[model samples]
Target: MKIQSASALFRVAGMAALLGLTVGCAPQTQLLSSSSVDRPITLGLSAADFEQAAAAATQSMLESGAVERNDGKKHIMVVSSVLNDTMQRIDTDQLVKKIRVELLRSGKVMVTTAIGLNGAEDQMNTAFSELSQSRKVDRSTLVKQKLAAPNMSLSGKILQRNNRVDGNKELVEYYFQMTLSDLQNGLAVWEGEEQISKLGSAKGTSW
Candidate 1:
């Protein structure tokens, strides 16, 4: 009985040591800082870049007094096309979403997702309209009641420029440019641009 118990104890200890070794050998996955972190020397756009650019653009727009509502009502805004003129494939919404969220939180602007340059972001509104029309519901009660024209429209473009610094290095620049236009007057109320540059190796592609 004593010998059997000793063998079992040895087996348990070996198993525990093996588990410890396995855990220790495993690579530790860590979370990096979202707001600011050391970026790789690559020309690709990152989440940090999008966030910073959006923040800067929104800040400029808000501080310029261009987003102010005169009648003490939240200004209805529509998002127009944000042209991506860069070589890399990126969604413009990654940057626009941040600005939209901030503006909405300020209670000064309401971004209408129901209408956009590409089309309606939410098709439910259109679907509902069709349903109401088909059912012969009161048009004044549903359509006119919910219909609101945007007072302002926001449009922008993202551009990229790449320059060869040397045989080993390259300089890449990205420009985030935005304009807030008055829908009624076709005037640009606010314009802002944010540029980000990175110096990196010229080996791999920036996309």
Candidate 2:
């Protein structure tokens, strides 16, 4: 067997190091969280918490059979007034989006972005409606195409409760409450609440 020279060995090592660095420093593709991974518990609402809450709410709604439309078709759902009662500043869509996605997949409901608490979810749709009016489009044709009113509305609130466990520890409870209401009858058909609690040091703020 022939032995390699020190200079040649050093050059090979340098090339290997460079290759390792290049691979290690390469940007990794980001992806949505999977169920197998353990989610971190923190002071504010987290992605995992939102996901769990959404899952629970959706499951409850589906099981209750309240999402069934009188027309014998998929219920048109309007997301409305998901009030944020907690101290944390969070877009309610973080939770609603998951529920909407799951509900759509189940083929039981369809969320209308054309209507919402804060006007329409799609500003372009609203703008197009205005343009049609300005252009003097036929009223009956515009009404048929531009107006699909929702049969049901989904609304809710997020509440937070805190209690001191000891001198250094505290227990925080978060409640995710959701309701599905019949717009025509003005009654809540389905309601669900999921609570998630966390114990952490009281030294820092959770909001």
- Number of the top TM-score candidate: 1
> Which lDDT values do the candidates have, in the order given?
0.88, 0.87
Which residue ranges in model 2 land beyond 4 Å of their true spot?
1-38, 69-71, 131-144
TM-scores, all models, native as reference: 0.79, 0.76
lDDT tens string, model 2, 1-207? Answer: 135587788899999999999999999966656662755569778888998999999999898888766776888899988999998899998999999999999998888888877898988777776756565766556553456799999999999998898688988899999998899999999999999998999997878
How many collisions per candidate?
Answer: 0, 0
RMSD of each: 4.7, 6.6
Q: Candidate 1 on 1-207: residue-level lDDT in tens?
A: 999999999999999999999999999987776546555445799988998899999899899999886889988999998999999989999999999999998889998868876677898867776766565776657644386779999999999998988788888899999999999999999999999998888886778
Best prediction by lDDT: 1
TM-score of 2: 0.76
Off by over 4 Å in 1: 1-30, 38-41, 133-145
